[model samples]
Target chain A: MDKFTVHTGTGAPLRASNVDTDQIIPAEYLKRITRHGFEDGLFSAWRKDENFVLNKPEHQGVSVLVAGPDFGTGSSREHAVWALMDYGFKVVISSRFADIFRGNSGKQGLLTAVVDQSAVEQLWKIIEEAPETPVTVDLAEQIITAAGFTTKFEVDSYVRWRLMEGLDDIGLTLKHVDEIEAFEAKRPSFKPKTV
Target chain B: MGRTLAQKVWDDHVVRRAEGEPDLLYIDLHLTHEVTSPQAFDGLRAAGRSVRRTDLTIATEDHNVPTTDIDKPIADPISRAQIDALRVNTAEFGIENYELGNKEQGIVHIIAPQSGLTQPGMTIVCGDSHTSTHGAFGSIGMGIGTSEVEHVLATQTLPLNPFKTMAITVNGKLPAGVTSKDLILAIIAEIGTGGGQGYILEYRGEAIRALSMEGRMTMCNMSIEAGARAGMIAPDETTYEYVRGREHAPTGADWDAAVAYWKTLPSDADAVFDKEVIIDATKLSPFVTWGTNPGQGAPLSATVPSPDDFTDEVDKVATEKALAYMDLTAGMPIRDIKIDTVFIGSCTNGRIEDLRAAAEVLKGKKIADGMRMMVVPGSVRVRLEAMAEGLDKVFAEAGAEWREAGCSMCLGMNPDKLSPGERSASTSNRNFEGRQGPGGRTHLVSPAVAAATAIRGTLSSPADLVGSN
Candidate 1:
């Protein structure tokens, strides 16, 4: 995981709700065992249309996404997050996010910032009107600032710390191996084993 | 205060806990499939780590497996490579894998319970969203991402925050022909897609108790479509009987002891939940989705709703977009929407019982002319069981193709897929845009409704087939 503190980038306004994982990275691109090179698959279906948001000239190379409510609402494929990051998105601002998608974002260091619908609307307005205006997402301050507008965002504190520090989750959990073994020792005898 | 079933299960799995920090919960089972796990295994190799508990983890090849022509090599090179990666990774890590052509090979969720690996009071995790299908046994089964899959493989545990519990109480007996799929679809329609966010749902009340284990699994399977990470039903004789003599189920004294512990796993009578929703199951009819999302549905008897019907801006916009993508008109009868294909398989409704129900509806009746219907079982086991019951002949004689098991056409990973602009009445979970294939449209339906729709060339329910049969 790469450390994330304050990232400044242009924004793309995806004015659609329930932008599910299937739309983000279709299942066709999931055949690759490796994670990189998914940039082409990001919104592959919608990108074909000349009028879609991401295909606009001004929104090219944008790293901040101001999206509708309930973004990433379906599927647990982390490929959704990878595709966003691979396509140059560092921060996704939405009114709400699916639980599993949000959790996956924390692990992968793609910042999912939760704000009220009003904030989302304002951000969309700012980004759509001036796509090149730089937006800064500050994890330390828990706020997003862009084009003279600022709004506080919500994120799990522990996740915030890990993101800022670039900590590996497996390493953090491995620190308590002894406690895990202790629990396993007390587990009931009837629990089925795979082998 | 008494704790809800979710809280009780969460408490039991805690390995470590502290203020301001998520609890370290022990995982009893980890299910994996080919699609989302290859990268996780690659990460472990890069990090010089090995699987911590192979005894608690199992893998299967489903998402990319070709359902037909079982003996031939996979026609898609990329798909074959992914499956090969899983075969190699599982062998290297010493994890048990049921690969393609294996007798036990199937969708991960379908095989887990059928083998008696899923039990009450356990915590199960998988990389697929439909892991909630296992929660029918009073367990906490959640879907995770590739990173979490790697974490679980390395440690057999997850750090998690507590979840809020919501009681979805469905009272009254479900009317005839109103299956659990209809009941759950109706629930999701009422709640909207995001209604269950940040909550674990517990299905309770008389209506839930009346459902068979397969029905309960169908209900829990789609909890994700409503934004719930997991959904559960308390274990009872229904659950026990389903698990009693499967391959991995406890035997002799172990079985007795397991049942004793399971008896204590249900929520106490006075247990309180963070939220409660009550529904009269008697009012539900055969349900189907008319839009891209599962929540965008209504009873089969209703008409396509106009965007003007929604006051919420997001919902209104979504409805308009859905109507356009689905090529549907407002005020059009749902039953009048025509379909080109009918897919009958997935983790949702691919069990033997599901096959039987559909076969019963198709018996002695042919699907409408030019209608393409495929009956792909969830697993080889399910296919074998259906064959033994002579359901395959029924499906074949009715003009539906009886195919091998795997997640065929559930998603677009395999060769079995819907063509662009094609429409299907599918028994799969999602009805998302391009879910079956690019530019493909899917309407989620139960197996029975799928069969009936195949015969009618439209979104019809089993009741419409009564006189025809």
Candidate 2:
């Protein structure tokens, strides 16, 4: 994980409510052992359509994904978040996010911002009208700004800190190695120990 | 401020809680499968770490294991390697394993509950999302990633934050034809699949109380669909009755004490939730997904909404895209959507009761031409029970394929798959694009509906096929 604040860049509006993990990275691509190099697999099924927003040439370098409510629903596959990050998406703006996906994304340092439905609609309209429109999502301020519209979102303080520091769950846990070791030493006789 | 089931389980499992730190929660049971365990095992090996509590951990081969020819080597090289890797890892780590063809071998979620390994007020973790199914026993169960799997493997504990509780109380009596599947489907559609996010949902009220253990399992199995970490029903007489006499359940005096503890698992009458959703079961009908997401569903009698009918522009575009991908015409009755395949098994509804229900619908009617139907049991024990009851013969006589137990067409992880452009009516939880197979359009339905669809070669309720003989 890299330490860098996320901001919406070259936003290409593609709004689909209840966009499921299966659509993010189909189960076919899940066969691979390595988590790396899923960029090509992101939205592979939908990218076949020439008219799809993601297939457009101008949106190639876009980092912001403006989506509808209930984004990332179905299947608690962390691969969905990985594919998005691997595909260079820094921030996903939606009215709401699936619980597991939201937690998984936050852990992976992917900024998942939940704004009011009206703000989502506004962003959707602006990005749809002007393809490659850029929206600034300042994690430090917890605000998303685009085209004279601004929205504030809330995230867990610990998750926000982890995202800002680019620390994964493992990294966060490793930070307390000494404490973990101390706790391990206090374990009861019947309790098992890691080698 | 009464405790919800999740809080009760969480509090009981919390070994320690310090300032600015999460709880060091002890896990009572850890289940592993082939799909996600390989990487975790590799991580442990890379770190030269051994499993902390082999007695508490159990491994099973599913997801990638074939439902046919248990003796033969898997044809898919990648899947074969994954299964082999799990066996090697479990053997090296001294963890108990129930491999393919073993009576204990089955869908991990189904086997855990049936074996009485999933007890009330326990904390369970698995590398698979449907682990929430264990919550039906009043346990706090949720899925974890490979790294977390490794963490639990090495430490026998999981660091976690607290979750808010949501009570989805389904009141009133469910109509005669409406099953637990219908109730859950209706809830998913109503909540738009993200309604339970960040909340542990407790299923309460009359409708949930009336459900059998298998039905409760089905209800909790799809909690992930609503973005809930887990869904639970408090233990009662029904839960105790289901657990009694099970192979691993407590015996004699221990059983009495266990039941006593289980009886106190329910939320107090004054308990308040962060969110509450009241559903009237009578209003719900047999439901089916018409689009690529479970939330994009309607009652069996309703028509697929046209893009023009959507108030939001994004919704309109999504409706159009889903319609195009599904090759469905707007405003057409959902029942008129023709399906080439009908699948009635998955962790969601693939149990003994589900098999019996499908068998009742397909007792004598032959499958219509061009319709391929399969009845795959969730576990080997379920298969044996179905055979003993002669339900397998009924399915075979009705022109349906009776497959061995595994997560068979719910996901095309193994040999079961749909060819490109094939559409299916499935009882599985998801309806995403290509969920069944490449270019395979899936419509989530109930077992009875899947059986009826096989007979009619289109979406039809079981009531429609009734008396047709």
Candidate 3:
């Protein structure tokens, strides 16, 4: 995963709500071991339509995506976040996001910002009107701004810090190795164990 | 304040908590399957980390395993490699893996609780969303991302933000022919798919208490379809009896101790939930999906919904899209919708009880001409159990193919998928477009409904077959 800080890029407005993971990357693409190069498979089903945002040249290479409320609403696949990142989306702004998708985004340094519904509608309007409108998302400031209009967003403080610092979670957890070992030794024998 | 069952479990599992951060909770069990574990195992190797508690982790081959063959090699190369990868990973990690032919091997959710691995007051995590199924044991079972899976594999702990508790109390007895699947679908249709987001829904009330353990598991299994973090039922004598004699269950002295602790897992009498929703179960009929998502459903007798019925613009758009994709008309009666295939198994409905219910409906009756019916068991053990009870003969006589155990047609991971535009009555959790196969249409139903649909070549409940049965 790459470090994420402040990103300013054109926005592609997704006008749908409850945009599920199955739609983001269908189950057929879930096979294969390698995790990279999923850009082509991102929205693979919808991409066939000529009018999809990504297919339109004006919205090409946009790193920010704005969508309606309740985005990333189904399945626990982190592949959904991978598809978005692989498609060059650094930030996804929605009024609400499924918990798993938001968590997956945070782990990959992709920002899932929860803004007010009015802010989402406003962003959709601005980005739809001007296809090449640049949107700036600053993680440190917790703000998303597009074409002179700005809206504040909320994220967990720890997530913001992790993204800003580009910290590796496994490394951070490993620092407490001794404590984990102590707890494991004291764990109940009656509890189910793997072997 | 009295604590909800979920809150009580969370309080018991807390290993560490700090300001401005989520609580680090101890996980008693971690289940893994082929689709999601490859990357996590790779991460551990890349980071030079070891699985923290191999004894607390288990693996199985289910997602991509075929349901038609038992002793042969996997036909799909990708699925073969994934299963092989799990074999290697589990061997290296010292984790107990129930491979394709193992007696205990099956869908991770099905095997865990049945084998007494999932117990009351425990916190469990899996890379698959259907992990919610184990919550019926009065435990916290949540679906984590692959990255989180790696985190838990390495530490035996997950940092989880607390969730609010939603009490879904179902009152009254279910009308004859109504199943747990119908109740869950009705709840999802009443409250949109995202209704339970950020909440651990605790199912309570008279109706819930009256259900068999299998029925409770079926209800909790589909909690994820409603976007709930977890779904739990209070541990009672029903739970204790289910766990008492399983292979991994505690011995006499330990069993008494375990029961004592389990008795405390239920919510207190005065427990106050963050939110509460009461459902009148007696009013529910056999339910089925009419559109793409799980929420776009109605009673088996109701007509397909018009986009005009939606109050939200986004829902309206989704409804229109669903109608177009489903090839359904606004006024078409749901019961009259024709289906090409009837699927009788999945993580949601592939247990012995489900098989019996389905077989009861199909007994001494032939399937409608030109219709295909498949019965895939949840696991090898379930298959053997069903066969021992002569359910296989019942299905075979009715023209339904009784398949080997695995997740077959629940999703299109295996070869048991419908052709494009082919409609099916599936006893699976999801009905998303192409979920059963690319361009396949799915109508979510119970085993009874699937069996009845097979006999009639249309969506139906056992009541619809009163003349035959």
Candidate 4:
């Protein structure tokens, strides 16, 4: 995972709400075993339209996604996060996000910033009005800033710390290997085992 | 304070707890399928870590396998590669895998519970969201991403934060012709998609307890649809009866011990929940989704709601978009809406009981001309059970295609898919746009409703077929 202290990038506004994981990277794109090269599959269904927001020339390569509420609302596919990061989105701003999607985002180092619906509306307006406007997300400060716009976003503090530190969670968990084994040893005999 | 069922299960699994750090919770069972496991396996290998507890892990080939042509090689190289990847990964890792053509092979959620590997008071995690299906057994079942999957594979535990509890108490009995699918759809509609966010929902009260284990699983399976962390029901005689003699279920003395522990897994009467919602299930009828999201639903007796009916600007905009995408007209009666297909299979409603419900509705009858219906069981075991009950003959005789098990036409990762602009009354979880296929419009319904819709060539419930004969 990459450290995400402060990221400055242009934003693209996805006006639609409840933009689910299926819409982010459809099930068809999940067939690939390799993690990279999902840039083509990001929003594959919506990108077909010439008028879709991301398809607009000015929004191309934008790294910040200012989307509607209830973004990433379905499926537990980390491929959604992979697709977003693959397509150059470093941060996603929404009024709300599904639990699994938010967890997946944190693990992959893609910052999911939850702002107020009022703030979301403002960000959407700013990005839609001027696609080139740069938005800055500061994980250390937990704030997002743009031209004449600024707002503090909420994130799990532990996740925020891990993100800024670029800590590998598996490595962190392994430090407690003895505790895990100790707990396992006490598990009941009747517990089902695949073997 | 009396601990709720979720807190009890969660506390029982806590391997380590600290002040600032999240609880390191031991995982009792880890279920994996093809699409999500590949990346996790790669990550484990990249980290030079070995699976800590292969005995607690299981894999299945479901997402990408075709329901047809089981005897032939998979035609799609990409799909085949993914399945092959699972086979290789599980073999190298020494995890138990039920591959395609194996009688034990099926949708991960379905096979787990049917095999009795999903038991009360366990912490179950899967790479798939519908892993909440196991929560029906009074367990703490949750869906995790690939990163977490790898973490569990290497450590048999997860670092997790505490979750708030919501008691969704459904009082009274579900009226006749209203199934658990309808009850859950109604619950989601009442709560909205994001209403249960950050909370573990426990279905309580008389109506929930009355449901069979399969019915409980059906309700729990859609917890993700409501944006909940998981959904659970307190284990009772119904739960024990379902698990009693399964292949993996404990025998004799072990069973006695298990049942005694399970008896202690429900919430105490004095328990105080973070939130509470009381619903009267007696009023619920056959429910269906008219729009894209699972929450955008209504009773089958209602008409399509106009966007203007929504007071919130966000909901209004979303409703308009859903109306446009679904190609549905406002004020049209839901039952009057025609369907191009009727699909009855998925982790949601592919169980043998679900098959029997649809079969009962289709017996000695035929689907309408120009209408297409497919009955794919949840697992090969479910298929065999349905066949033994002569449900296959009933579906075949009704002109509906009886197919093999897998998650066919649910996520459309398989060959069974809806064509562009096609509409379906599907007994699946999501009604999200393009969920079945690109430009495919799905109206989520119960199995009985799906069968009746196929016969009438419209969105009709089983009760609508009454007196017609």
Candidate 5:
């Protein structure tokens, strides 16, 4: 995990609500056991279209993703977040995100910024008119700005800290090793009854 | 002041809490599968940790297992290794596993509930996301990661943060042809898949109360689709009736005591939820997904939304992109969207009841020309029951392929896969791009709709086929 500082990059907006993990990285691409190089699988079906946003020349190297309400719904596959990271998406801006997907993203050091629907619509309009319009997402300020409007967003304090430090869930859990050890020591030798 | 079911479960499970520290919560049931458990078990071995509570842990093989030829060796080398690893790991760790061909072997979610391992007031965890399916028994179930899987394996406890709760109440009676599947699809469409984030949803009201155990299971199975950690229906007489006389269910005096405890699991009338949503069941119809996400769905009678109709510029772009991938023209009637394949099985709708429902529709009818149809049961037990009822023959006579049981085309983890550019009407939960296979397009529908679509070779409701019978 690295220090939590906001990095800004812009792309041609590819906004869709409830963009599930299956769409992020389809099941076929998940054949391998290893969790590396899923960037190629990110939106693989959509990427086939020559005119898709990712294929647009101007959106190249963009790290910020502006999306609609209820983003990242369905399937708790962490590969979705991994794909986004491998494809250079650092922050996802949406009105809301699926709980498990957001948690999975947070665990992987990807930032999810929940903004108001109106602000999201504004950003979409700006991005639609200017495909390469720059959108600034500030982790420190918990705000997203594009065009002439700026909107404050919310992120859990603990998750914010983790993202700032680029810490994953395992990294966060390992931070309290002494506490965990003490708790483990108190466990009974006998296995608990199955519910 | 209203506490949702998720809040109740989370509060009950909290063992200890300290400032800036996660609570150490006991896990009641831990379900494992071949795909994710192998790595976690390896991690446990490297750390010299034995499974702390073998009784609480259970494993099954589904993702990589083939639907055909149960006795033959797995042809896929990687899949074989995964299954083999699960077997070896479970044996070495003294954990219980229901391997293929075993009567208990099934999709973990289905087997857990069917065997009474999933019960009210329990906290269930699995490496698979649809573990929420257990919540239909009023349990708090969640999907966990591999690292967390190892944590549970080593300690039988999960570090947790609390979640808020939401109550989604569906009132009034569902009209004929509207199934529990339709209701869930409608809910997902309204909430846009992320509606229940950070909340466990408690489904209530007359409509939910009327559902059978299998129906309730199907509703909860897709809780993950709406970003919910779990979806619960309170344990009642209906639940008790469903669990009675099961192979593992409590018997004699213990059954009475269990029923008493289960009765107490429901929320009080005054219970408060952090958020609330109300849906009118009468308005829902046989729903189907039109786009890549489950939320991007419409009633079977509706037409695909034109991108130009979207006022939000971002929505327009998304609509356009979805149309392009789906190869569907905007404003076209959804019923007119032709499909090449029809699949009826998965944890979502692969039970004996689901097979019977599809069989009822396909009994005397034949599949339309150019339609490729397959019926895969969720478990071996389901397959056997379907066969006993002659539902397999019904499907076969209707021009559908009847095969063995497993998670077949739902996620395409095995030999069952969709060819490139193939479009399918699937009873499975997901409709994401290539979820059926590479370049495969999926239209999510209920079993009834899937059967009808198989006959018509396009999207159609069961009502459309009822007249023909």
Candidate 6:
């Protein structure tokens, strides 16, 4: 995972609420074992239409997505975040994000910033008015500024810290390996064992 | 302050806590399926980490397994590789895997409870979202992502943050002919898809308590549809009776001790919640979704809602998009909608009781011509139990296809799927665009609804299909 802090890029406005993971990356493309290179499969179904937002020519090459409230609303697929990251999105700014999707994004160094609904509306309007407007998201300051429509976003301090430092979760958790083994040793025998 | 059932379970699971980090909450059980485990295992192997506790982990092949052609090799190479990868990975990791033809093989959610592995006061996590179904037993079941899957595999614990509690109290007696599926659909419609976000919703009040174990499972199963990561119900006599004497449940003195501990898991009378929502169950009726999302639903008698009905522009746009995707029109009666297929199985409603409910409606009725109705049990054990009672014969006589259990047609990972532009009245949760198949339309309903629709060739309730025999 890449370390993220103060990324500047053009924003793509996809103002769809409750845009589920199925819509993000359909179930058919989930068969592969390799974790990366899902860019083509991202919104594969929606991309068929000539007028879909991401398929529109001007929106191409944008690395930041400004979606509506309650984005990434269904499924526990980390592939959704992978698709976004693989497609060159460093941040997904929304009014609200599904819990699992947000957690998954945190692990992949993809920033999911929760701003107020009005702030999201502001960004969407600005991007719609000028497709090439530069958007800057600063994790340390908890603020997003695009076309002078600046808003402070809220993120968990721990997640913010990890994103800024480019931490690998599995590696971090491994530091507590002794504590994990200790917990396993105390587990009751009645619990069903896979072995 | 007294703790809610979720709080009590979460508080008890804390093995170690630190001032600056999330709680190191121990996991009692971890479940795996074909699609999600391979990557996590790869990550583990890449990092040279073995599973911290193989005893707490279990795996099954569901998503990619062919339900109809169990004897033949999987024709889809991608799916075949997924199943094979799961088998090899489990064998290498020292994990127990229930394979396709095994009697215990089925949907991970269903097999866990049916085999008594799902117990009260336990904290369960799975790679799939529907794992929330186990919350019916008073456990804290969470749907986790693959990175978290790797985390649990390594640590047997999650660095977790606490969630706010919401008491969704459904009071008053549910009218007859209304199933738990109807109750949950109505709740989602009332609260919208994002209502339960960031909170653990506990189903409480008179109506929730009166539901059977199967009913509670169906209710908790869709908690994800309402945007809640986990859902809970207090442990009671009904819960106790269901967990007793199952294959993995405790025996003799162990049984007594387990029950004693479970009895203490319900919320105290004065326990507080972060929010409260009340529903009068008597007002609910058989429900179905008319749009692409679970929140776009109405009673069986209600018509497709107009975009004009929504006050928010965002909601109106979503409704318009959904209406276009579903090929529905405003003011059209929900029951008048035609369906190409009726899918009567998934982790949501493929248990024995779900089968029995659909069987009662299917006993003497022939399915309408040109309608494709298929019943897939949640697990092979559920199929065996249903056959022992001759329900399979009744289904066959009624023209509904009976097949081996898996998540057949739920997400369309297997051979069972609707062709493009096909619409179905399905018992599974989620009606998202292309959820069943690419461009396949879905209407979420209960088993009874699925059976009646299959028999009538349209969206229907049992009341609409009377005298079909």
True contacts kept of each: 0.85, 0.33, 0.51, 0.80, 0.39, 0.64
Cα lDDT for residue A14, candidate 6: 89
Candidate 3 chain B minimal-lDDT segment of 10 residues: B460-469
lDDT, model 5, position A182: 66
Worst 10 residues of 4 chain B by lDDT: B460-469
Q: lDDT tens digits, residues B284-367, model 2? A: 889999987777889999999899988967668878988998999988998889899999888999999999989988887899
Task: For residues B1-469, write the lDDT of model 4, one tens digit per residue.
Answer: 7999999999999999988788999999999999998999999998789999999999999889999989899999999999999999999999989999999999999999999999899999999999999999999999999999999999999999989999999999999999999999999999989988999999999999999999999999999899997999999999999999998999989999999999998999899999999999888999999999999999999999999998999999999999999999999999899999999999999998999999999999999999999999999999999989999999999999999889989996889999999999999999998999988999999999999999999999988998885
Error of 4 at B147 (Å): 0.8
Which number leads on DockQ? 1
lDDT by residue (B1-469, candidate 3, tens digit) is 7888999999878777789777878889999988888888999999899988887898999988888766899988888888898899989988888998889889888999888888888899998888888889899999889999999999888877899999999999999889898999999897778899899999999889988888998989889888897999999999989988887788778788888888987898898898999999999999999988898889999999898987978889999989999999999898889999999888899999999999998999999999999999998889999999999999999999989889889988788888989999999998887788878999999999999999998898888888664
- Give the per-residue Cα lDDT of candidate 2 at A176: 58
C-alpha lDDT (0 to 100) for residue B242 of candidate 4 = 92
Off by over 4 Å in 6: A181-190
Output the worst ten-in-a-row residue range by lDDT, candidate 5 chain A: A186-195
Candidate 3 — which residues are off by over 4 angstroms? none
**lDDT score, candidate 1:** 0.94
Docking class of 5: acceptable
In candidate 1, what are the lDDT values of residues B231-331, reduced to their tens digit?
99999999999999999999999999999999998999899999999999888889999999999999999999999999999899999999999999999
Better of 2 and 3 by DockQ: 3
Q: What is candidate 6's lDDT per residue for A12-115, written digit by digit as tens? A: 89878899999999888888878999998899998998888898888989999999888998889899999999999999999889998998999889999999
Q: Please give, for residues A72-185, the per-residue lDDT of candidate 5 as tens digits.
A: 776666778878989989888888887777777766678888888787778778877876677787889887777767889998887787768665454344455565566556
Q: After superposition, how far is residue B372 of candidate 2 from its true place, in Å?
A: 0.6
DockQ (C-alpha) of model 6?
0.70
TM-score per candidate: 0.99, 0.92, 0.98, 0.99, 0.88, 0.98
Candidate 6 local Cα displacement, residue A31, angstroms? 0.8
